[model samples]
Target: MFKNIISKQLYLLSYLIRWTLISIPVSVAIGSMVALFLWLLNWAIHFRFAHTWLLYLLPVAGVIIHLLYKLYGQSAERGNNLIIDEIHQPGAGVPKRMAPLILVTTVITHLFGGSAGREGTAVQIGGSIANLFGSWFKLNEADKKIILTAGVAAGFGAVFGTPLTGTIFALEVIAIGRIQYNALLPCLIAGLVGDVTVSAWGVHHTLYHIDVTDVSGQFYGKHLPVSFLLLAKVLIASALFGLTSMAFAKAVHQVKSIALKVIRINWLIPVCGGIIIILLTFLLGKPDYLGLGVDAGYPNAITIVSSFHQGGADFFSWLWKLIYTSVTLGTGFKGGEVTPLFYIGSTLGNTLAGILNAPVSLFAALGFIAVFAGATNTPLACTLMGIELFGGEYALFFAVACFTAYFFSGEGGIYAAQRVAAAKTDDNYLKKIFSKYRP
Candidate 1:
């Protein structure tokens, strides 16, 4: 029995060591590619802002992007969903061309003032790179899935500068209530290595701060720092955040369906979308809703950074961003929804703080991670992300907000390929909710 136990332990240790060795090069490649993508994204955003006239040619740019995909990007067009599906059902390997295809299209989308995010591009790059390496090594299907998971971890960690959260996210995101523990080691190694590699290239992520001093005061004779009232406000705002996530997901699906039905010419769909976005920009009298919405360094810019302060964002800022992003992506634009979701959640949280008379930065921070948790149905990952992005001073509040939002966000998510390994509620209740949204 002792020899058997030792043999099993040695086998496990050998397995871990082998995968760790493989993950090093995979993470390094993903990190380097993501760093380049981010650098180009920043340049594209700045160039668009400087020109300002590029917005007028959005439709033309849209047409060219449409042709690029229509001609040679059919497989790559599936984006992150393709990666998730491949992990779940390991079919033909992820394509090699996905990397350049998404990188160029996403940059073009941003260059022409399309409202989108960089996460999708980075993730596709990682998946493509991993798939290429897997094919080169002649990996089996099971090993291919594991490498793909590691690729996702590398991309997410490098892009957001959150290695632990990225590891958990790659594990948690495939199924609704289950995690792929088998990939944990490789994912962790890849996430950490990817983040470090990106930093080595002089790439930096955005910064966010929360003032915990006032909110940490004792209340009602309890030693706890967070107040009951603040917790209550978090609950209320988080529910709204969840509902908004559902709405965004539903809107994207509905818009795509409607656009496809209403338009006969496939290529003209994005052109029409570009025209609508341009008209909306003129109507709104500002371009704040365009691009990444992280920070434009311009006065009166409404962005994720702006949402942390009073009067930094308008009450309807979140709604407009939702509409803009949904339309931009639904009409066949290339980009991720995570950053735009951050914009929506933070801005909505900022609006709610004024109504609840709570701390603006505190609630914005809660909504930041909570909405993402709800949208992705990964509360644990989002909670860790909150602690990673902000400090752990408000971890309890982060947990409360993230878990609540996850419950309220419903069965649907931004990734339709994600399956329900376990239901959040009883069968009857979940069935009722699904029925309402089904048709």
Candidate 2:
């Protein structure tokens, strides 16, 4: 009996080891290609001549956005939502054309100065690549799911250079209260490979820059008690950030709902949305809120946190981001809203930090993950992301804040097609609520 058990364990272990060796490099390669395209696209928008043609761009851009949506929106409807759908229904894979549609639309959005994120574009491209592999391998339903998960990890890891977080994101995103342990090895390998590949390819990924030279180990040793208080504040502030994120999501849904009701033609949705965005930019008298807003982080334009001081950049800039993102996404303009969520969280957290005299980097990191947790309903992924992007020094604080944000944000998710794969965190409440209002 003992020999039989040992033999079985050895077989399983060997199988996993072999699989990890093969999958990681392949997945990472796919992810790297996706990242290269995304980086090139973003660079073109930010540095190429496109940025110089602001005066005559709006109306022409509006026409292009209108035509793209009218012709391709329905088939492309399932980009983010489709990924969520596949998590609930295991055998599913995103359509082949979804990647091209998203890539084209996203490039158009950036070219025209639409406020959005790049992850969506990268993920779709990766998914499209993985989908081809799945077909070639003739993978079973379970294997297909593994491929999908690896693709997500690879894509995210390539962009963020945080393999652990990307791996966790792949496991956490599919289910509300469950993860597939069997899928971990492939996801981890893919994430690591993707990160290494992107780094090799000269992409400038996002990372937090903090100046901690002033604080010493003695300070940490003597002020160990202060860590708890800082964490406590982080927890409370993160919850507020989560709530605000929920509010932003609700606002988008409500606005989209109203727009659909008023404008029956599908093309008009993007047209009207583009017009609103253009009008807002003109009224604001600048283009600071446009695109990914990474330019906000360039040089010393005041971090989102410093905007909170009286007559500082915080209040209006944050509000403008909120309005611009809400309108741009809510109006059927095709793009990813995840990066905007980051901007929102960081700005809100920074504003709060300025008020409380807390460490702005600490609060900014917390807000970045907390809002992501609330928006995606993936607490573990959010926590991992904070550690990966900022560093593990505040891992405990990130975990606490992320879980709090996840709990307070409730059952709603950013992706409408995301089904409840498992029971909610609060089973009884979820059951009751689900019974009353079926998603």
Candidate 3:
């Protein structure tokens, strides 16, 4: 027994050493290159060409995307789906043409003010690059998956500068109930290396600012009643927030289905959506809600938060954003939905926080996690992200709100291909559809 234990320990130690030696430097180099490309891409798109209205150039944008898709065929249509496909099928790596095509299309989308996020574009680039390495190295099927996961972590870490969260995301996102433990070391290495490289290049991230109170502080003791009440409010808020998020996701999916059914042209969906966005912008008299809504974070900006006390942000601010983002993403715009969810959540959370007389900072934090949990169906990841971004002071409240949101959000999510390993209820179709695919 002693000999077997000693041999097992030695084997584990050797594996760890080998992985560390291989992963660190490789991740660092790959991360640095990806960061540089993304930095250049963002600046060029935002400054050089963002002024171009989507309505004016949307036809051309449609032409380009259609041409690319027609050229690449169905493989191009599988952008992020390619990642999920690769995980399910080993010999499949993302096509070499994917990176350039996505980069070009995404740049065009952003430059023309198509509502979108940048992280999806970066992840495609990073994953495609790592796919090349796996193919060249003739890595085994398992290692191929590992490298792809590491690539995702690297890309997310580089963009967000949250290595730990990125690492967890890579591991947790592969499937709902199962995690690939073998992918952990590689993801950690890639995430850490990517964040370090991005920071070294002077890229900065927005930190969530909140006041922390000690567990035993006099103020906390006095505020205990309020805190408990706030927790209850958060739970209620998160439930409603989850329903809103799920509605947005399902609405986009439904629109895409309708577009595909009604417009057999296939290429006109995004163009039509773009036209609607333009019409909405004219009708609403504000373009602030048209894009990714990052400007919401700016001081004195026309954000939902700023207008909360003044009777909410222009009735359609949130709804317009939801429509633009949904159409932009669902109709094949290349970007992430996570950032937009944050925007929506913050807007809604801030409004409720004001009504309940809760701290804005606390509500903002809750909003961040609750929306994220609902959108991604990643309650645990959102909980950890809250703790990491908001400090440990509100861990209890954060966890409660996150899970509540997740439950209310149900089986639907931003990622349609996400596997449902287990369900809280046997009545749902999640069990029927996903039981066969659980890995």
Candidate 4:
């Protein structure tokens, strides 16, 4: 028994030391690349703002993007899905070119005013880098998955400056209703190290705050300081947030299918998409929905941060962002859906708060993470994200909103490669209930 105990302790210590050493360099590589991408992305977005004529060249940009993929993209065109598929099955290695292909295409997408996010690009970079390193190290298949998870954790954490959320997200995003805890230590080490590496490079992430507190003057039970009525409001709003996520996912998927079918010429799909985006800009008489809503060229623009205040967003801001992002991404634009989801959620939360008579900032904060949680099926990570970005004052409310949104959001998500480890709701449960005795 003592010998067994000694052997176990030795094994555990070796495991810790091994992963720690491995995670640091992986984190540093991923973090450095992500920092570079963010810098280039910033310059691209600002340059487009300086010269709005680039918007007119969007069709040309789209053609270039399609051609780049057609000529050299190959498996790299799969983007994040390819990485996820590689994680699930370890053959057909992630190409070294994936890093540059996604990095360049994503910048081009944003530079030309295509509405998309950077998270997917960062993640692909991380995965590709990890895959490359895995090859050099000649690690076994199982070890490769662990290192890849760490890479994902590093990329997400470094990009957002939220290490804990990154760790959880890396674990939870692989499959719904399940998490790969075996990778926990490596992911945590990578996430923390990666975030530090980015900050070390002087890259700053967006700041968000929750300006209102909903603690009632009267306390409930022995320790509950929040009002039950406010919780009730959150429940209602979270359900709506879930439905909105479903709508966004379904809209993007259907639009992509329809556009691909209708435009048999292939590359013309994005061309038509670019033309439609131009028409929409004229139709709306504003360019507010053309890029990542984090920053706008025009004054008084509604953004994720702006939605935290009352009257900051139009009643239809959420809908417009959804439509804009759906069209941009569904028609072959290369970027992530997360930031647009953030814009949609916060704006929608702003509208709902007004109708619910709740605190605008609080609801917006909840919506920001809750909608992402619903869409990505990563409630725990989003709950931590709320704490990281805002504060822990509303942790309970954050969990409530995120988990409720998760259940209601269904199993479909932005990543088609994601598998359902467990169904959210067994569709045949009712049938089983009715025929239980017969069976």
Candidate 5:
């Protein structure tokens, strides 16, 4: 019995060792590609700003992007959703062309001042690279899934510089309220390697700070560490953040449907979107709602960093960002929604802190991760992200905001391919009622 047990343990160790080795190269490739993409993205943003007149050519750029995709994108146009679908149910596999198509088109979108993010583009690069590697090695279906998960981990980790969050996100993102432990080891290895590789390329992620000096208040004749009032405020703000996430998701889908219905020609959809964006920019009197919204290197510019201070963002800034991103992505622009979501959440949180009389930075930090958690249906991952980005000084509050946002955000998410493995809330009665009416 002892000899048999030892042999079984040795086989398991060998299996893990093999996968770990495979994940290293996969993650290194992903991280290197993401670094290159980020470098180009930064260049495009600066170039567009340098020549503000380029904004007027956005419609033309959109038309070109549309034609290019229609001609050669094929199933690659599905983007992150396609990767998610393959992970859930292995199919034709992620196309190799997806990486280049998304990279070039995303840069074009940013170059012309489109409101979008880079997560989707990086993820596509990672997934495409991993799938190609898997095919080269003739990996079976099960191993293919693990390889894809590792790719996602590498992409997310490298882009955002959060390996733990990236690992959990890759495992949790495929199914709502479910995690694939089978791929945990590979995902961890990939996330760590990817983050390290990106850093090795001299890339740096944005920094955020949260002040907790006044987070403590006396309560009920005892000196409590954290203020009860602050917790209450966090709960309320997180609920609003969740609702905003739902609104953004619904609006994106609705706008896409309306655009397709109104426009007979597919390519013209982005043209109209570009025109509308220009009009909105003129009306708003500033181009703050465009591009990544991380930083623009201009004083008093509304950005994720600016939203952490007082009087940095205006009321309804989040709403405007939601509209801009919805229209840009709805009209078939090539980019991700995460950076925009961060802008929306932080700005909205800044506004709420003014109303609630809470610490602006703390609330902004909470909204930053909570809204993403709600939108992506990955509360645990987002909670970890909060800790990674803002430190663990307010971990309990982070958990509260993230979990609450996840609950209130409803079933809709940015990734339609994500499956509902478990019901978030008890709906047995609703399910029974609907079942009785089924044909």
Candidate 6:
């Protein structure tokens, strides 16, 4: 019995050490690559600001991007979906070329004034880098998937400086209503290490805030964190957030479908997309709805940071961003969707706060995570993001808003490859409950 116990402990110890070995190197490499990509992305955006004429060259840039993809990027074109597909079924193990290809294309998308997000780019970078390391280690089918998830966690954590949220998002985003515990250890370690590595590279993440005082004094009491009425408002508003997310997801898919049908010539889609974007920019008379929607350099820019203040964003800020991003990405522009979703959510939240008579910053923070939660179908991760980016003081509200948004978001999400383990929409449950009474 003593010998058996000793052997069991040894096996457990070996398991821990083995994963640590695989996960650390993968995380470090992914983190470094993400840092480099972020640096390049910043340079591209700043350079575009310096040269406004670059905006006019957007259609040409699209042509070049389409040609590049047609020539050597078909395999990597699926982007984040490709990574998820590989994880679900270990085929070739996420292509090593995906990292550089997406990195370059995403940079180009931003450099030429495309309105897109960075999360997808970071995630693709993470998955590809991690899978490559998995190959080097000669990991088995099971281990390869874990490493892939770890890569995603590392990329996400490093990109956003939210290790815990990254880990949970990587795990949760793979399947709706299902969290894979198989990658728990590897993902956790990779996320922490990845976040630390990016910080070591002197990359600074954007900061957000949420003050309790943003809400009315009537909602606060000595015993309760927030009044039930405020919670109700969040519930109602979160439903809209979920609907907005659904609309955005559907809009992207619809735009792509229509563009495909309307434009028989494959390469012309992006060129036309670029023209529409340019026209929109001229119509708006500013480039506010371009890039990541987090332009820190533009002091008066409408961004995630500005949405917390009253009148910081215009009434239609969310709608404009949705249109801009949908057109940009739908027509073959590279870049992720999460940051723009943040912009939309925060702005929408800002608008709703005014109407609801709630605290502007608090609702903005709620929108920040809630809409992402809805769009990604990862409420738990977005809730953690709220806690990480804003503050833990509103953790309860974050969970409430995110979970509500998730239920209302419908089955659609940003990642097409994500599996549907279960869906909890009220229509099905309500129909079931009232079916017996329908007679």
Over 4 Å off in model 4, which ranges?
217-224, 426-429, 432-439
- Where does candidate 5 stray beyond 4 Å? 429-439
**Candidate 2 vs candidate 4, TM-score winner:** 4
Worst 10 residues of 2 by lDDT: 209-218
Best of the candidates, lDDT? 5
lDDT (10s digit) by residue, model 5, range 1-439: 9999999999999989999889999999999999999999999998887888888998998999999899999999999999999998899999999999999999999999999999899889989999999998789999999999999999999999999999999999999979999999999999999999999999999999887547777977888888999899999999999999899999998989999999999999999999999999999989999899997646788999999999979999999999999999999898999989999999999999999998899888888998899999999999999999999888998999999999999998988888999989879988888999999
lDDT (tens digit, per residue) of candidate 3 on 54-96: 4566556756777777877457566665775686576556877
Alpha carbon lDDT of each predicted model: 0.91, 0.71, 0.71, 0.90, 0.93, 0.90
Over 386-426, each residue of candidate 4 has an lDDT whose tens digit, in order, gives 99999888899999999999988988988888889988877
lDDT of 6 by residue, 14-57 (tens): 98999998899889899999999999999999998888889988
Query: All candidates' TM-scores?
Result: 0.96, 0.86, 0.87, 0.96, 0.97, 0.96
Which lDDT value does model 1 have at 249? Answer: 89
**Worst 10-residue stretch by lDDT in candidate 5?**
211-220
How many residue pairs clash in model 2? Answer: 2
lDDT per residue for candidate 2 within 1-439, as digits (tens), equals 9999999999999978766765765676666676666676667566523454552364456567667655765545667666655645654467777767777777777777777777777676666666667777777777777877788778777766778887888778777777877889888888888878887777776556433412222354574423555666777897887787777778789878988999897667767777788888789766667777655424445433343223334555666787888877777665677777777877777777777767666676677789888888888988888877777766777888888888777787676765566755667886898898875
Model 5 residue 413 distance off true place after TM-score fit, in angstroms = 0.7
**CA lDDT for candidate 6:** 0.90
Look at candidate 4 and give me any clashing residue pairs. Answer: none
Clash tally, candidates in order: 0, 2, 0, 0, 0, 1
Counting only residues 3 or more apart in sequence or on different chains, how many pairs clash (N, Cα, C under 3 Å) in candidate 6?
Answer: 1
